[model samples]
Target: MNAVSAALDDKAIATGPAGPLLGDADFQYLRAFVLEHCGIALGDHKHQLVQGRLLRRLRALGLSSFTGYCELLRRDPHSELGELASAISTNVTSFFREMHHYDLLVDELLPRWLHEKRREGDRLRIWSAGCSTGEEPYALAMVLAEAIEQSGSKVDARILATDLSPQALETARRGEYSLERLAGISAERCRRWMLRGEGEYEGLACVHPRLRELVTIEPLNLLHPWPMSGPFDAIFCRNVVIYFDQPTKQRLFRRYAELLPVGGYLFLGHSESLHGVNDQFELIGRTVHRKIAE
Candidate 1:
C-alpha cells in the first residue's frame, strides 16, 4: 500500500521467490547494528546491498521476514553478530594489490628496515590488517622472502595477517586459490612461492609451506581490543578504513599510530587518506605514510 510496501512487493515479484523483503525499518536497524558492532558506516544507498547479502542468512535461519531476523540478532547478538559482520562486510582483494606499496617496501622500506634491525638484532615484523583471503600477506611474504635473499640478510622477517571474518580467515589460512585469483602474479614468482595443483585440483594453487611459514593468520576485530603488544616495523591496512565514519577513522588511525614505532610506515587504501584523519604520519609516497620521528 505504501511506498516501502510497494517496493518490497516489486522486489519480491522481480526476484521471483526471493527471501523475505527487506523494508526501510529493517535496513535502518541492521545498518545501525552493523555500524555499532563493526564500525562500518553503511550509507542509505547500501540498503539494496545489505538486503542482498543478508538474504542468505535469512534463508539459513528459516526466517520469514527481515524483522524476524533482526529480532534473532538482537536476542543473541554475540553468536549472530559474527555472521552478520561476515555477510555485510566486503572481502574483495587480490595478489599484489596496489603494487606501489610493494615497490616501496622492496625499494626503500625493506632496505632501511633491514639496516635498522641489523643493529637491533635480526628481527622484522609486519602486520597486514584486514588481509582478506591471504593474498596481501602472502604477497608481502614473497616480497620479504625475496628481499632477504637479495640482500643476503638473515632478517627474521614475519607477517601477522588478521581479519574480522572467521570465514575469510579460514580461506586465508588455507592459502589455496583458483587460477582466476592468480592474476597479476608472474609465472616465475608463482613457481617460487606457490605450489601448483594438478589432476582433480587443476588450476588451483596453494601457497608454499616456505611462504606460509612467514605468515601467521588470525582473527582480529580492529574495532575491539587488540591482544598483541606491537610496535611493528610497518603495517599494511589498505582499503580498510573507508567504511568507517570520520570519527571512527580518526580513532583507528590514532590506534595505528600508537602501535607503530617512530618512523614506522602506515599504508592506506588508495582512496583513503590521513590528510584530515590523523597528523602523526607524513606522506612519503602514494597512499603511504611514515610515522613522525619523536
Candidate 2:
C-alpha cells in the first residue's frame, strides 16, 4: 500500500469529527475518477479511509461535503486532479533511498556510458518519473556530475525529474532540504555537493548550482499524455507504481520501453516488478531491468 493508504489504515477507520462524511455515490465516483485519471485502485474497504484523508482537501477548497467535491470534479476534473492525487497519495522518499541502485550507476554504468557516449558525442538522458521532492534527481546529479568530471567528458547529459504533485515539484525546484534530511548522504558528499546555510536558514542545506543545473524539474501526470519524445538512457520510477493496477502498470511499462532505446535501463522500487506486466525488459539486477531487442 502507498503511504496515504497506510496512514489511513493506521487510523481507527472512523471519520470522527472530520468535516463531512463521504457518501456512497460520491465515494464511488471518486474511486472511478481516481482509477481513470490517476491509475490508482481504491478498494471497497477504503471508503472510511478515503473519507478521512479527503477531509483536508475539502477544508482547503471550502467544500462543505463530498458531494460538492464530486460536483466540482464533474465540472472540471483537470483543475483539481493533481491536488486530489496529492491528497490521496504520499511522497515518501529520501536521498539515495535505494543505495544499490546508485552503486550500480557509480560502479559500472556511469563509466561505461560516459566512455561510449563521449566517443559517440551523444546526449544522455535519465528520467526520474516520480521524483517526489528533489532528493532522487539531486542524488542522481551528484553521481552524474562526478562521472562527467571524472571522465572529463562533456557528453550532453541531463536528468528529467517529474512529479504529479505541484507541491512536490515546487520543493524539487527549490532544491533545498533540512540537514536532518541529509542523513542518507555521506559526509564527504555532503561537504562536496551541499551548501550549508547560516543565520535564519541555519538548519538547511541547498543543492549546489551544478546539481541544480543538471536536473530539470517538471510536473507530469503519468496517466496523462507526455510531451517529450526521446530515447532516455535510464528511467528511475521507484516506489511510484505500487498504487497502480495491472493494466495501468502494463501501459506505463510499455510507454517507458518506447522512450528507452535498446539496452537502456528501467529502475523500479524494490517492492515493484514487471514480471507479468511487460516483457520488453529483462531483469539484470535487484529491481533493475534492461531493455532488450524484441
Candidate 3:
C-alpha cells in the first residue's frame, strides 16, 4: 500500500460514523483521476487534504464510504466530474490579491494595446484563465475601465474569464459579494464600480452592470481542449500552475505562449516561475512575462 493509503486505512477502519474514510486504493485512484482530468497532481501527502475536502460531498450524497463516491464517479463520469473537481481544487481568491499586476496593466500594457486596437479598429481581448469567483476578471475590468476613462480612449475591451469549477463560475456570474470581500478597494472605486447593498442586503456589494458587462464568465477545464480561438493581448493565469506537475506546467505555458503574440503579456502567480519550464517569455516584472518569441 502507498503511504497515504496505509496511513488512512487504519484510521478509516477505526473511525466509524465520524466520517467516511478515504482508503489507500481510493486515494490512489483519485490521485490519478484528478491528474488525468484536471492536470492537478495531488501528492501522497495530500491524502488527508483530499479526504477532508471530499468528506462533505460524501455526506451530501449520503455515501457511506469513499469507494462508493469513486464508484459514483465511474458510473457517471460526465456529470460527476465537475463536482469532483470543485471539491478537490482550491479556490482561494480576493479582489486585487496581486495589486502590482493591475498597476502594470494600467501603466504599460493597456496603453500600447489600446493604441494598436485603435489603429486597426479591433476590440481588445484578455483571458483570465483560471479565474476563480470573479475577483481576477473584475479586477482586470476595473483597471481597464480606469485606464480607458483616464486616457479618454474609445477602446472596446472584453475579458474572457474561465474556471474549472462550475460553482465558482456561478458565483462569478452573479457578481455579488459580501462587504468583507470588498476590502482593499478604494472608496472612489467602490462608489463608481460597485453597487452598495442596502436594507435586507446589508453588508453586500455587487459589481456595477457596466463593469460586469466587460467580463464574460465560462466553465473551462484547462486540461481539456479549448474551444475559443485567441490572440489575447494579455492573459492572467496566476496562482494556478502551482498545482500541476512539471510537465503539465510546461505544456500549459507553451500553450499560453502560442495564444499570445510577440510582446503580449502573461501574468503568473507570485510564487510561480517560467525558469527552466519555457523560455518563450521574458521576465518583464515581478511574476510577469512578455512573450518575446514565437
Candidate 4:
C-alpha cells in the first residue's frame, strides 16, 4: 500500500486504545448508562466495543476520562445523551448486506407485495430499523427503483430508515461512502445507484440524487412512541434485537406487530430471533418471520 494510504488507515483505526477502558466500576457505569438511556441490554462481551467506539469521541470532546464522561452523561438530559448513545451504538452494515434477503425481496417477495399494493394507490412502505449510516435502506431503495423501472410498474415506494444515532444519520443524509464500504455493492448496482466520486471526492461513492430522494433518514430511538403510523408492508430490522433483554424485545416486537399488517414481513439479524420474546409472529424462514395478525 502507498505510504499516504497506510497513514490514513492508521488514523481511522487509531480512535482508541486496544483494550477495555480501566476499572470495572467504570465499565459497569457505561453498561448501566447504555441500558438506562438507550434500552440496549449490554453485557460483558461489549465492554471492549463500548470503550473502543467512545474513546475517540470522549477524547475529542476533551473529557478528562471515561469516569468524567460517564458522569456528564449521568447528569445531562438532552441531545448530548442521544449523541453519546449514537457514538457507542453498533453499526456494521453494508450495501445489499446478506444477499439472500435482498434476493428474496426482489425475486419472489416484493413482486407479490407490489402486485397487491398496486391496487391500493400503488404505494409501498418499508422501514429499515436500526439503519446505520444509511447503506441498507439506500441499497433497498435502489433495488426497488430498479425493480420499478424493470417491471414498468408505477409503484410508489418509500423506505423509512431510522437509527438512534444522529451522527450515523448525518452520514446517511450526506450519502458519501468510502471505497471500502462500497465493496459489497455489485458492479451493476453500483453503476445504477451510485455516482463514482472524483476530484475532491476521490475514492468515494455518492448515492445518486434520484435514489437519495426515495429514503427519508430520521433520528429515532426505538424506545420512543414510534412517531410513525403504519400498516407497513415489510420491516427490515436486522441485527438489533439481540441488544435488548427478553421483556424489552417482547415489548418492541409487539409494537412492531402493531405497526405492521397481517402477513407483513419482519427481518432480523442472522443471530437474532423472536423465538422466546414474541409468539405473535410466525417464523417462516431461518431468520425471517411474518407477523400473524391475530
Candidate with maximal lDDT:
2
Model 2, runs deviating above 4 Å:
1-16, 119-121
Total clashes, candidate 4?
0
Per-residue C-alpha lDDT of model 4 across residues 160-268, encoded as one tens digit per residue: 9998877788899999999889888888878877898899999998999887778999888887777889878889999887677777788889999998888889999
Q: Which residue runs of candidate 4 sit more than 4 Å off their true CA positions?
A: 1-26, 44-49
lDDT of 1 by residue, 1-294 (tens): 322233343434223266566788878998888888889999999988988898898777766567777777677776777678889878789999999999999888898888767653577999999997899999999989888788778777889999888788898999999988988687899888888899998999999898889999988889899988888999999888878888889999999889898989999989999987899999988998999954
TM-scores, each model vs. reference:
0.90, 0.93, 0.92, 0.86
Error of 2 at 201 (Å): 1.1
Question: What is each predicted model's overall lDDT from 0 to 1?
Answer: 0.85, 0.90, 0.85, 0.79
Better structure of 1 and 4 per TM-score: 1
From the highest TM-score down, the ranking of the candidates is: 2, 3, 1, 4
**Predicted structure with the largest TM-score when compared to the true one:** 2
Compared with the true structure, what per-residue lDDT tens digits does model 2 show for residues 1-294?
322333343333324465667878889999999999999999999898888888888777766667777877888899999888988887899999989999999999999999998964689999999999889999999999999999999799999999998889889999889999999999999999999999998999999999988999999999889998978999999999999999999999999999999999999999999998999999999999999964
Superposed Cα RMSD, model 4 = 7.4
